[model samples]
Target: MMTILDALYLLVGIMFAATAIINLRDSLNSKRWKSAGFWGINAIIFIFGRYLPPLANRILVIVMVLLAGLGGLGRSGKPETSLEQREVRASRFGNRLFIPMLLIPLVTMLGTFAFKSLTWNGALLIPAGSSTLAPLAAGHDAGNGAGGRRKPLVWRRSRLSGLGAGGG
Candidate 1:
C-alpha cells in the first residue's frame, strides 16, 4: 500500500516540474538553463528518489547543493503581482487573513489524533516516518478551507470586515 507521503511527493514533484518548465522558458533570466536544471533535478528527486539507490540520491543532493552554492539558480525578471498590489491586498484583508495561518497548528493536532488509528486493508494509513507530515498536509488543506467564505465562522467575519466575495 502506498503511504500518504507518496501522494504528497507526487504533487510536489509536479509543482517542481512546472517551476522547471517556467524557468526553462524564462528568457530574461541569464541563468535560466541552470535554474531549470536545478528545479528539474528537484522534481526528479521528489518523484523518484525513493526508488533510486542511496548513493545516487546522495549524489543528486550534493549536485543540488553545489548548484545552489555556485549561484546556479535564478528567477524571471517578471512577477505576477507588484509590491504595491501585494501591500494593498494585505491591507484589504486585514487580521482575518491570519485565520488560515492560526488554524494550521490546531488542524494538525486534531488530524494527528484523528489519523492515528485510521487504516486501510489493516495497514497503517500513514507511513511511520511521515506521522507528522501526513497530518501537517491535512492541516494546510484545512487552514486554506477555514478562511474561505463557505465556512460559517469566516463568512460572518468576512462580511463584517466588508471584504465581500473578493478573492484573496
Candidate 2:
C-alpha cells in the first residue's frame, strides 16, 4: 500500500535510472544530442512532476516525448560525427552540465530521509498498527475529550512548545 508520494518518488527514481542508461547508450553510440536531450527531459520531468499534480505530470511527459522525438529525428539529418569529434566540440563550450544532473535524485533521497528522520522519528504509524508508543505519535490524542476526536499537537516555533489544538 504505497502512498501517492511514495509512488511519485519511485517514478522519479526510475526516470533518473532510465536517463542514466540512455546517457550511457548515447555515449557509446556517439549520439551526444540524444544524451543532452535526454538529460534535459530528465531535469524537466523532475522539477515539474515534483511540484505539480498528475495532470501537469502527464502534460510535461507528453511535451518531453514530442521534443525528444523531434530533436532526435532532426539531429539524424546532420552529418555523421565521431564520438571523439562530438566530445571535443561539446567540451569546447564547457557544456558538462549533465554531470550534476545525476546528483538531483541522490540529493533528493538524502534530504527526504534526513527530514523524515529528524521530523517523524523514522516511523510512520498508520493508525491501525500495534505499537506501544502509538499514543505518543503526533496527532494521537486518544483521550483528549471533544467526543474522542484526535487533536493534533501544534508546535509554536517562537515558544518551542507543543499545544494540543483542535482544528475547528
Candidate 3:
C-alpha cells in the first residue's frame, strides 16, 4: 500500500540532506555546525518521521525551534554571488526563469488525474484520498528538474471531462 507521498518524502529528505551538507561545508560561517545540525535533523525527520513516534517527532521539532531561536540557522556572511552578478544572471534569464514556477500547477493537475487511479502490483499508487496532494508534491519535484514535459492529450481531455462533471 505504498503511495507517491512516500517517494516525495524521500525527495524532501534528500533536499534537506543536501542543504545540511552545504551548510557543513561553509568553513567561513562560525555557526555552520548549528545550521547543519538543524538541516540534518530536518532531513532525518522527513525520511524517517513516519516510522518515529509522534512524541519523538514533536521533540525533534522543539529542538529545531530551539536551534533557530538560539541563532543557529544562517548563511555565510560572504555572498556566493555579488549583487551585480545576480543582476546579470537575472537579466539573462528574465521571464524564462518563471517557466518552472508556472509548470508546478500544470503538472500537479495532470499528475493528480494521471495518478488518481494508478496502481502498482495491485496496490494504489497514490493513497485514495491524496490525489491532489501527492501530485502537488510530484509537481514540486518536477521543478528541480526544470522539466515541463507534457502528458498525452488524452490525459488533458480526461481531466477536462472530470472537471466538467463536477461543475453541473
lDDT of 3 by residue, 1-168 (tens): 445688888877887887788678767678889989998999999999999999999999999999999888765644344457656766877787777678789999998889888988888878888888877876776664563245422233232233232100
Please give the CA lDDT of all the candidate structures. Answer: 0.73, 0.42, 0.73
Q: Against the correct fold, how does model 2 do in TM-score?
A: 0.27
Between candidates 2 and 3, the lDDT winner: 3
Tell me the lDDT of model 3 at 100: 68
What tens digits encode model 1's per-residue C-alpha lDDT throughout 1-168? Answer: 567778988877887787787678768778888888888989999999999999998998899888888989865554345457666878988897898888899888887887777788998878765667777877776776866748432343233334332211
| Global local distance difference test of model 2 | 0.42
Q: After superposition, how far is residue 161 of candidate 2 from its true place, in Å?
A: 59
Q: Clash pairs of candidate 1?
A: none
What's the CA error at residue 13 for candidate 2, in Å?
3.0
Model 1, residue 167: what's the lDDT? Answer: 13
TM-score per prediction, in order, is 0.75, 0.27, 0.74
RMSD, one per candidate, in order: 7.6, 21.3, 12.2
- Backbone clash pairs for candidate 2 read none
For residues 1-168, write the lDDT of model 2, one tens digit per residue: 543344444555455545545444443345555555565556666645556787877876776677567654222122344557556655763534333344444444444444442323444522222222222221122212221233222211111111112111
Runs in model 2 deviating more than 4 A are 1-11, 14-18, 21-26, 39-48, 53-59, 71-168
